[model samples]
Structure formats: C-alpha cells, structure tokens
Target: METIGKGGFCKVKEADVRVFRELLKKSTGERVEVTGMQHMAVKVFNRNVLKGQKTSEFDPFTGCLKMSDQLQSIMEEIKVWERNSNPNIVKIFKLYNDPTVPEMYLLMEKAQYGQIQIDLEGGDYLTKRNAEIEVVAVAKAGVHWPQGSGTDLEKASKWIFYQVAMAMEYLHSELKISHRDLKHQ
Candidate 1:
C-alpha cells in the first residue's frame, strides 16, 4: 500500500477493499467475499513513536512507561470510532491489530475530497497544518451568482456549517467524544 497522507503519529495509506479482505482471510483462514468499490484509507500508527513517555501506572509485572498521552489518545480514537455507526461519522471497516508488530492499521471508508482548509486573510493560513484551499473553489456554484446579491454564498456557507455541526453533535452527544483540534492537512 502507498501512503496517501501522514500525521504526527500515523500514516494514512490507500488500500483496496479486496486486498483487505484477502488479508483478513489469510489471518483467520476463513473465506470472505466483499462486494463494493475497492477504495479505502488505512491509517497506520507506530506505537513506538512515543516510547519514552512516562505514566503513573509504572510497575514491574505490568509496565506503564509506554502509557503516554499520545498513545492513550490513539487508543481512545480507535475505541470510539470503531463502535460508532452514524451517517455523519466515518465508518471503520476493520481494525488490523498486529500482535507481533509495533504498528496498527485502521481500515476506513475513504472520503471523496481531501481535508478542509480555510484561507486566511493575510494568506498565511491558520497555523499551516492544512493546505491553503480556497473557500470559493470548494463552494462550487455558490460563488457564481447574480451581482449585488450574496444570498447564494450565505446559503452555501450555512449549509456547510450545518453539516459540521451535525457531525460534532453526533460525536459529542451520541459517542461522548470531544473532537479536540481536528487539524487540516
């Protein structure tokens, strides 16, 4: 699989659904057939990235030095997203937890577009995490309207805001998960 994107502790790769099915079949030795588009995103997380982080649960029998803040966040994300089945949320197809390896793969449905970004006024962008994507370009037909009227743009913006609000509400109210700092790419 080829890497499509990368974050602080994870690399997202484009994987085919058929390939994933074969992987599962090889591991479980059970024949499986899947009918769908052969497109998905697999997030690979390296557990050893934050190996030096210390925690309060340090002990001899069961160590706690690996229980870092980043690791905890990663685990929580997987737990929450894997259990949810909402229309506004991303669906987790499968979780490939390699017991012998130091990495984990989260197979999920791929979105049609890339990460959303806001173009800053001074052209510097908001912290440089996301690419400078023009709002006008994303708005599609909303930008082209009759002169002296901003109703279309306003409606489009409101629609986008509403979609985001719905996703947030699903995450917070239904899943009890606070999506903190969903940075752009």
Candidate 2:
C-alpha cells in the first residue's frame, strides 16, 4: 500500500481493488456482469490513538465531542459520504468496521490532482516539509502579486475558484451538509 495522505489519527493509503458493475444489455432486457479494477484510497483510522486521551463520563460538547469520540464522527462521515454522489465530491466505495480490530478502513476514490501550483507574479518557491510554499514578498506598500502578464494564470485560478465554490454551494444547497475538516492534502 502506498501512503498518500495523513491526518491527526489516520493515514490514507492507495491500493488496487476489484469491482463489479452491472451494465444494461440493449438486445436482451437483462444486465451484464462487468468486472473492473480501480485505485482506491483507504483511510486507516487507528482507534488506539484515544488510549492516552481523557474521555470524561459526562459527555459534554465542550471538547470531548459530546461524549462521542472520533469513531462516532467517522461513522457519521461514512454515512454522509455513502449518501452523496457528485462530481466534485470524492466517491466512497465501502467502510470496513470490525469490532475485533483497532483500525477502521474507509475506501474512497483516489484523487489524481492533489494541489495546483501557479507561479504568481514573482513568488519564490520554498520547499518545506514535503510541501511547496510560494512566498510573495511585497517590496513596496502598493506593490501586488500577479502582475499584468499573468492572464492565463488568472483564468486558471478563477476556474479553480469557481469549481471549489460550486462544490461548496452544492454541498450546502443540495446535500444540506457542511464539510468541517477542509484541508489542502
């Protein structure tokens, strides 16, 4: 398994899985069995991480998460992901929750594009901790980045902004759900 991303208590790994799809047969009013393979990102959440954490008897919503732990939150997340089907949202295939195991696996579609890097105006690319940071140093008070020549870059940035905005709008309007944990990775 290839590790793709990481979280506070979990890590995502990429793996190949076999899937079966039912296709409609035009000639015979029947469905055809089709086998396919897909690359899936599995989120491995370790419940053992809660060992040292203090979980109070009084399940207050202050910081203890209303007495419910990360497991409950993950379950709720799985339900939301399983219900929603959109182009902007990543598709969740299956969730493996075993009582005997300390880890829970959440299977999801592998995202191809992680982050977009556009050389704005004159930003210096700084490689730090496996992530690239574009540092824009303004020399003067009225100076700005993305000077006139970056027309194509402006369009691409605008397009990305629109797509993210649309996705957020769809989640709020159509699904009536809000993503609490939004991250770059």
Candidate 1 lDDT at 114 equals: 50
lDDT of 1 by residue, 149-172 (tens): 577656655655666689889888
Over 4 Å off in model 2, which ranges? 18-37, 50-65, 117-148
What RMSD, rounded to one decimal, does every model reach?
Answer: 6.8, 10.2
Which stretches of candidate 1 lie above 4 Å from their native place? 23-35, 53-69, 117-151
TM-score, each model? Answer: 0.67, 0.64
- Which ten contiguous residues of candidate 2 have the minimum total lDDT? 130-139
Best by lDDT: 1
**Candidate 2 residue pairs that clash:** none
Expressed as tens digits, the lDDT of each residue in 36-100 for candidate 2 is 43666778888666443443233344544354565666676678778776786777876666668
Position 134, candidate 2: lDDT: 18
Q: Would you list the C-alpha lDDT of every candidate in the order shown?
A: 0.66, 0.58
